[model samples]
Target: MSGVYLIGAGATPVAEHYGRSLADLASEATRAAFAGLPEFAAHRVGALYVANALGDRLAAQGHLGAYLSAAVGLRGVPAVRVEAAGASGGVAIQQAVQAIAAGAAEIVAVLGAEKVTDQLDDAVEAALALASDAETEALHGLTLTAQWAMLMRRYMHEHGYGPEAFAPFPVNAHANAAKNPLALYRFPINADKYRKAALVASPLNMLDCSSVADGAACVVLASERVAREVAAEGVPLVRLAGVAVATDTPALALRADPLDLAAARASAHIALGRAHLGLSDVDVFELTDPHGIAAALALEAMGYYEPGAAPRHAADGAITPTGRTPIATAGGYKARGDVAGASGVYQIVELLRQLRGEAGPTQVDGARVALAQCLGGVGATAATCVLVAER
Candidate 1:
């Protein structure tokens, strides 16, 4: 297999693009991705992988691969939409890497775009519910937030904590997001505000939940030969290094431990092993969690923190911008605005910025090796990638 490098990365500011269509958002991101790189052109892209989870339900459209490829001027390119619920974008990236590694394409474009705010809140909630198990979860009115809330309650009960234990995650996210101009909620928040925030579900307040917004993120991935040809002097080359994806039981009720993100652990460990690196070698992580509790659960599940310690770890400022395990550096879903299916792509874009030393205030100092993981529907599907910056 050939090596794959991220040749270019770009994203639109996460927000409620009230008038923009899904294709428009995707096109803007695609153009920005290729903006400073003259070596690759839109027409020259060998394949296009589009990730849109609610285009059909929210946008009232389908066949996003062709629709978006043409919208972005990649006419006639072999394009297909990748849907793995919230993991769509990360899975799209995984597929793009495989294509380049298998010599199926020299350069492939991965675009993760989602439009949710265009519809009503209730409508969006129902659409998001579809990501959960239809017969067991969604059909019984188990919304995604409710699923996470259940996990939060169980974690608190098991760990002997109150509802406020998860505040630090979002507080840190908002603080870091204040420096991210592209982030939606750029203001820093405090525990007081978290305490006053309205409840989305019992134990999960609005502040704890990620904003449902509309945005797109895109990346241009190239083969090792193409990357060498496009290399700019004095700039570090960011390689994908290793990637692995895994899935768990779709229904949360079937899991041995509802809080155990089994797929997340498997994917991250497998990818890290492939890169021949240990957990300590990672400088940063871009983990996809819908809220603070999800973030806490993800950290523990991925082995970043011991079980029942992630909340306290965050509370103690261990997950800050300069801490031992910095996460959600680009504001994450809380501050960056969760564009659902496109979040995985956003994670990659943010990681690329960190690797390039251009993350501004959210930059993890001296970050070299990073992990980016995205989960689909209450941790059912997990996609993990190890990125290495070669100086």
Candidate 2:
């Protein structure tokens, strides 16, 4: 398999907009993504890969592959729709890797898009149902939030980690979003606001949840040979070092621990091992943070903390953008809005910006190696990727 490089990426300015479907937003941003790059105007795009979680449910934009292909004017190329629940985008990239490695394609365009605001109520309910085991968990009347709430209680009882330890997670994301021009929730959320916010499910508050949003992002990938032929010096080329996916038990209650993200930890270990890098070698981190607790659990499962101590690390400001390790500098799903399948790809897009030193105000200084992790439905499924700047 040939090495691949992420040559370009573009995202719609994150905002709350009405009556827009995910495909529409994706097409709009993808067109702009290619149009803005004069250097790649003549380059041949061999395939189009789209990561969409909600296909016909929220906006009824069915047949995303054909729709986006025609919309982006990349006719006659193979178009693939990638979906792994919330980790759809990351999995889409994983497919792109195999395509490149197998000589099936040299250039792939990956897009992650979601329209959650059109039918906010249904979207919320549908997203929650993703936490279920479908045959079992869904029949048992479980929503993602409900599962997390129960898991949170279990973690609290098992490890003495309370709601207070998780408070800083969302608060930090909101504060970080305040600095991001494209973040949906730009206002600051302090400890006072955290204490007073209405509880959606006991420990999880209204502020703890992500807002409904409609947006899209796209990235262009080319073979290593093509990157050397086209890229400029200042524009750092990020090579996809490794990618891995793992799935745990479907039912949260049936897993090793409802609060533990076994799949995420396993996927990260595999990806980092393949990349020949360790936890300490990653310079930037971006996670699919649908809730504050999800972020804490992923960090702990990924060896960032010792089991129940993730909350304490987050509370001590160890996970903030300016802290020792930054997770979700673009505010994650908590501030960036959870767009289901799009969340994982969006995290990769943001990390590309950080690696290229093009993140503007949110840039992580001196970042070289970057890791992005996305968990699907209470850690039942997960995808992890490690990328490094091409020297």
Candidate 3:
């Protein structure tokens, strides 16, 4: 709130784009962010942060931060790459906040991109490994979907929720994604289709799982002085009220309460306390849904509802953009394809657009307080950020 701030953001589709690589897509998104920020040129950027999910798997892209920096013509700037499973983007944002908080850089650019479609099956297996407890979870043949199935099944058994109870989240997300030009899955979905789709892991059908795709998103942060001097009213400038990242026990089975997300609880609590607000004060909420259970449990753990009632709220049309409390108006990872590191950045980008009144038809009317959550692995690591619109 005192120094570092977001000045601009960008999100681009990742499906098929003239045969561009993941690095290429990231560079393009970075350029788009810079283009969006007509106030600051490339040379003004002092540091670069690139959030990536599959840099090592695809093309062995190990040093993508430097690769992207040179590609954007901002060579020689200190570059750092962040990989926090799905929370990579949130981690990237946190890194920029620290750099600015420590007075290391005044202007920073953060980008998140994933080239997933290139190897779908391998990616799924590898992504599951991130959650694998070498001595426990993975050794027992537990995959992400398998763990999610157990969590979803447990929630249903304990709360009387069923597969049909969670349909509205993807349904509403698809409805909103239809309006977002950058979303990969723009087509609207229906309950019947979702119900009929083949089940991958019980209680989770094809529609229940987000599609595999590619995409990139970017954000530019400038110091408070630069933010006030750079732009006029139309451009969105949300103050980074607070950011908190925390970790919990790695093994999900040994967790005090499988349904109780300690990471999310700690992260959101710190963020809200730092921002001097509470859950009810937030106008918008964007929680990560690497799997459907993630959103349900996160909503419950973050005090939105008791553990048993989240699914009911979701099915009752409570989390849609048009609902009483709008959530993931851009479809989130549930409907919008999850681009790993880019997923959190996309959430921040959509929230920023909503705050600026630039989210075409999906805009939330008078959004002021926004919160974003990104969870890593099967809830082992999580990050939360709170953004407030400044007058």
Candidate 4:
């Protein structure tokens, strides 16, 4: 198969952009991505893949492909919208890579954008709940937050842990976000602050969750054939070494084991297998984190740590920007605020900065390979991507 290279990427600050429309955010990110390549012409873009999970439900707009393509000034090209709840961005990137490998297009542009601040807080919560299965999950009034809470409770019961064990995840994220200008929460947090946070669900406090906000991220990919034609100065070759997504039962009740995270595990194995690398070979990992529990489960399921060891690893400062197993170097979902579907794209942007040695304070020393995974809901869907910076 032909390889796909990440040419450039961009993103907007995760915030309540009530005044900006989805098109505005998407176009702004696209412009930033294009700005990195002054010699790359707009005519070379063969397709546009826009990922947005809640544009119609919250913003009264749909067909983001046509909307954003026009906004980005791309004409006479194939354009489409990709949706898979929060995994939409990662899935869209997968689609673009497949297009390039199949010789359908040499250059593809991917944009993940979401607008939710237009609605009231309650309305936004209701809209975000669309990630749940309508027939089995949402029908029972189970929100994503409550589902994660259940996971946290069960993990604690099985592992003999306390709520304080998970505090390091959010605390680390906030500390990293304190240095990220694009992060929504620009302050550091400690375990005491986390312990005192108000409870939203049992064992899940307000600090345990991510704030939903409007945001956009864009990335341009080209076939290896085209990549060699262009020179990206001061950086090594960043290739999409492998990409895969896996699915499990959408209803939490139907899953063989609710805490297994089988989909996430399978996706990670497939992606890493194709990359010919293991978790230890990855310099950094970026897992979607709506809640700290979700990230802990993903880390274990992806074989990064023992089933009950992820929280403890966080406590050891192993997940800090320059730690042994660096993760969420760009504040992650906790402090960057959850951009929902666009978060997958934002993860890529953050990793690209690390690979290029452009991440000032958060730079993982000598980052060469990275892993990022985004989940749709719980573990119903997981899209994982492995990137390698070839020297």
Candidate 5:
């Protein structure tokens, strides 16, 4: 298989862009990506892949791959849309890597875009609920917040934790976001504020949840041969060392152990093994953080910490950029803002920034290897990727 390298990446500020359409947001992000590679030509893109979760329902837009292709001035390229709930962006990049590895494409552009905040609150909630099992979870009146709350409740009950134990995740995320200009929430929070926040669901407060926002992120991938050419032109390269996707039962109730997050575990195991690296070798992690409990569960599932110990790790500040694992280096979905499908791509972009030593105050010193994981529908689906900075 041909090696795939990320040549350039970009993202719009994670904020409500009520004036921009989804296609417009996508085009802007694409333009930003191309700007990083002055030697690369946009017209030379061989394929385009778009990842989005609710463009159809939120903006009445569909056929995003072709639409974004044309909007970005890469008309007539073979294009397709990929959707796997929140994992759409990571899966789209996986597909692009596969295409390059199969010798089917020399250069590809991956865009993850969403226009969620334009809709009413109830409408946005309904659109997000589609990611869950409609018949068993959504139709039965299980909102995403409620499901996460249940997970938090179970974690607390089983581990003897309190709501305050999970506060560090959001607190740390907000502190990191204060240094990230592209993040939506720029202010830092304290444990007291988190405890006083209003409850969205039992055991889950407003601060514990990621807010839905409008944003887009893009990355350009190329075959090894093309990557060498770009590198010769002075562009730094980041190799896609490993990529994998895994799935589990969609209904949370059907799983034998709801806290296992089996899909995340499997995907991370496969991805890390493919890279010939272990969790200890990773310099940074960009895991899903749509909810505080979700972040803790992902940490445990990814082997960063033992099960039921992630909350304690969080409280110890072990996941901050200066700590042992250094997760969510760009504020993650929590404080950086959750753009649903766009989040996975945003994570990749943040990783690329960290690898390039461009993360400003949030930069992980001497970061060389990074892992990014995106989950869909409460771990029903997961996509994991390992990246190594080219020396």
Candidate 6:
């Protein structure tokens, strides 16, 4: 297998692009990604991978790989779409890396785009519900927020805590987002605001949930030889050290422990191992936080904290960029806006910024190794990747 390196990354700000189609958003990102590389050749792009979850339901479009490829002027390349619910972007990255490693493609383009805000409120809810168990959960009207709220309630009961304990997750995310130009919610919030926020579901307030947004993110992966050529031209190379994906039972009711997040743990463990590193070696983490409780569960499951203690870490400000385990450095899903399939790519783009020392205000000083993990359908699927800056 050959090594793969990220040579370019780009993203559109997470917001309501009222008149932009999915292809338009993706094309903009792709153009930005190629803008920095003077040697970029469209014909050299051997394959195109597009990640999206709701294009058909929300945008009335399908075959996004072909659509986006042509939109970006890569019409004849082997193009395909990757869908794994919320983990679609990360899984797309995983596939791109594999293609480069296996010599199937020397240069691959991965684009994750989602148009989520264009649909009606009820239609958006229905499309999101497709990520959950259709027969058992969605059929019974178990919306995504409700499932997360149930988990939060159970977590509070088991840990003897209250809803306020999870406030730190959103507070920290918003604070970080305040410094990120591409973030949707660029204002900080206090614990008081969180406590007083309107409830979307019991124990999970509106502030605790990620907002739906429309956006796209893109990254270019190259073989070791191509990466060296790019680096020779002064482009900073960020190595794709490791990547892995894992899955769990689709139905939450079937899990032995609803909050375990076994898939996250498994993917993180494998990715870290492949990177020849440990938890302590990771300088930054970009884990999914669609809901505050989800962040807590992910932190614990990824071994950043003891089970049931992640909330405490958050409350104590341990997850801040200057803390022991800095997470959500780019505002994360809570405040950055969750564009569903595009969120994972957003995380990777943020990590690349951190690695390149380009994260203006949200930069993690001396950050060398970064980990990004995205979860799909509650905790049913996970994709994890470890990246290292060239020394």
lDDT measured at residue 49 in model 1 versus the true structure, 0 to 100: 96
lDDT of each: 0.89, 0.79, 0.79, 0.87, 0.90, 0.90
lDDT of 5 by residue, 237-319 (tens): 89999999999988899999999999999999998898888989899999889778998999899888899999888888888
RMSD of 1: 1.2
Question: What TM-score should be assigned to candidate 6?
Answer: 0.98
Clash list (residue pairs), candidate 3: 14-214
Across 97-147, the per-residue lDDT of candidate 3 in tens digits comes to 888878788888888887766665655565656654657887666776777
lDDT of 6 at 154: 96
Q: What's the CA RMSD for each of the models?
A: 1.2, 1.9, 1.8, 1.2, 1.0, 1.0
Query: What 10-residue stretch in candidate 6 is worst by lDDT?
Result: 34-43
- Residue 206's lDDT within candidate 3 is 79
Query: Which pairs in model 5 have colliding backbones?
Result: none
Clashes of 4: 0
Off by over 4 Å in 4: 232-235
Per-candidate TM-score against the hidden true structure: 0.98, 0.95, 0.95, 0.97, 0.98, 0.98
